[model samples]
Target: MTETDTLRERVAVELTRARERTLTLADAVDDHDLVRQHSPLMSPLVWDVAHVGNQEELWLVRDVGRREPVRADIDTMYDAFQHPRADRPALPLLDPTEARAYIRTVRDKALDVLGAEPLAGRRLTTDGFVFGLIVQHEQQHDETMLATHQLRTGPAVLDAPPPPAPDVPVDDRAEVVVPAGAFTMGTSVEPWALDNERPGHTVDLPAYAIDAVPVTNRRYAEFVADGGYDEPRWWTADGWAHRREAGLTMPMHWHGDGTATRFGRRTDLPPDEPVLHVCWYEAAAFAAWAGRRLPTEAEWEKAARWDPATGRSRRYPWGDDDPTARHANLGQRHLRPARVGAYPLGVSPLGVHQLVGDVWEWTATEFTGYPGFTVFPYREYSEVFFDRGYRVLRGGSFGTDPVACRGTFRNWDWPVRRQIFAGFRTARDVA
Candidate 1:
């Protein structure tokens, strides 16, 4: 096959994989739940369902293909920046049946464009970046919809077998020291890397120790038991206020009796599973209580991608390869994070485990563009969100699809957001 044929095949496969996931999550819930706003922090599931199609219609069908509008009337209704989540349920949204049909039509047209359009000549068409963007966008919504399921109060509508046990015995409390050095950070040539992740740059840093695996329920529970939340000394001024205001004493789904809610069912918290649904403040407080700190974005990336032996950075912790089931617990294959010691092969050269998936590890860095960052496609995608109010969360969560998760891939949210599938590992500077 020619290079163009190969590229088209890869893009087609990814787009299909992402769409399948989107439909599965949307179909899992009944129409009532799909339309219901599970939390103010999230859009109605039905809205997300329709929005992904609208995005594909706009970017792929209309923009890239130069085709006429599919559903121009409802475009404003689905504009995320135009309407907040809290106001969406009250809007005239497409019913479940209509939403599904709408996406089907959009996808049909999009695939036609995929087959006919030349994969070059236009900036968006170059290397199938627009298709990649749409795939990642849809997968991101799938993850968001999964989070909505976690927030919804009802019988579980989703189920998956638990993630496999550790391939090899793992020490739950181990830490790996990333020696002081400079390493290339971010992506210079990753085809689908967003504007914010562009322009790879060298970042020099001092030695620091990072947790080999994410912080687990067992360890975080110690923080709760020792009054970590009550101690202001362990929290920033803003974090202390938010903690008290929100009554956050433990992880979002956790109950005092060592149980946590998962997909609407109450189950005993698996002690070894990486803690999930934590805000940046909670992660920071826990780190302080444990006499460590959250790793900076640079520190976290270096630990995950910098290979001391080669003096180079890799696309992922394991290497420059797409993730598979054996590498990390990604793509919603399992609804929750795997055990702390799982995915021995996913470990980085520096010994950091589960850096690409499980939970988004909160970092000390604020959301900002890297050095020489340039906006491409659009500014709203990432450039507009460079405000300091948002904290950076490196690593992907179990719900994240591999197409959307890479070492340079970055996710960010307000520090007070606990609805996201987030957790953290602590780090300490070497003396």
Candidate 2:
């Protein structure tokens, strides 16, 4: 009824949604495949699923004194922060059925307890905060899983790769014009934004135009067809070296008879599907080939945040509502990149399609701190990858949790390694 009640209800709903997502993701992967070491960045799928459940229980129940049910060995098996991956493979893992059941039990217990009492006035302890962090953390891993699977299995799961755009379209044709103004950027106000998005600050921008849609598979195909991969002129030194080392000739989930195909499915190229599995180098090369460049992080936020009438920050591209299937491709059963132009309503203020959820858009800026940036108590958040080699990525992907797709959310990865749900869109400085 009241605002406090509404907030509490939202939190409860979020917890339910989080549980549902974890269960669905866990169920999607074959039990036998859960143990495979997909990549160094990825944990075994089983471990991640149990870890998510354990984290929720540890946070809301054990730490909060409701002290509801949890697996006895959870501390030993799923305590990821304390025990890293090197230690995971050797642990006595629960059987897939048991693990799923345990996860459901913990989730139900957490919901029953939290639902009874509103989370409104509850003061979260450090451990409790860690639980919240794990939720987002696990959601990120889920996205990675989808990406890794696509990379390994090809576009059999994707709807299909779209045909390349016709001549990159006119540069200004579908641009969402953002007016000049100052707006807050970052996570200062939100209680749960990642450290990188935190200490929100105001940013000033001159007028700018951003693409109304993410770069399509067809558009990127054009780049590759134009020798973007072979052209040293299109690549940075680091990018070229990465290309040479990885032997990357196309986007990660592409294959066909000398043409690009989406992962996991045989279908006609859709031309409207957003590109997926592109590394920073590929994204950059495609941009260069098209005579445009990836949007800077600030430019992206500006275009997504600008308000036409009042010029205020829009909480999300589609407004403050949480993501839904109608809004974006996230939380779907297929867990693959969707057609690019599918969610017209999800466009950012500046007309950037799929700004919130589809595939993360690679930005030109290096991952770095804003003014007054400080690390969280744990060192692994932002400080782990401040090196110049990493690039910033924005917008959450189809595999991403809705909560993790907040406009200010910041994700980073090495420019060369495109393993985890990485993709890009292009932008150019308006004349």
Candidate 2 per-residue C-alpha lDDT over 1-431 given as tens digits, one digit per residue, 9 for 90 to 100 = 96545655666666666666666555666777676655565677787777777767776667664674566666767766666665676777777887788877876776665545544455453223444565676676666555555544522423433222332333322557666678878867666776788787888877666677777766777777777788998988888988998899887656644344334554454555677778888888888877888888998887776667676677788887777767776654345566656666677655667787767889998998888888873556687778667889988776778777788888887787666676777777655
The Cα local distance difference test for each model comes to: 0.92, 0.69
Candidate 1 lDDT tens digits, 142-168: 999999889999788899988989867
Instruction: Give each model's clash number.
Output: 0, 17
Off by over 4 Å in 1: none
Per lDDT, the best of the predicted structures is 1
List residue ranges in candidate 2 displaced over 4 A: 1-8, 39-41, 66-91, 112-135, 151-173, 176-180, 256-263, 333-340, 374-379
lDDT of 1 at 50: 95
Over all chains combined, what TM-score does candidate 2 have? Answer: 0.82
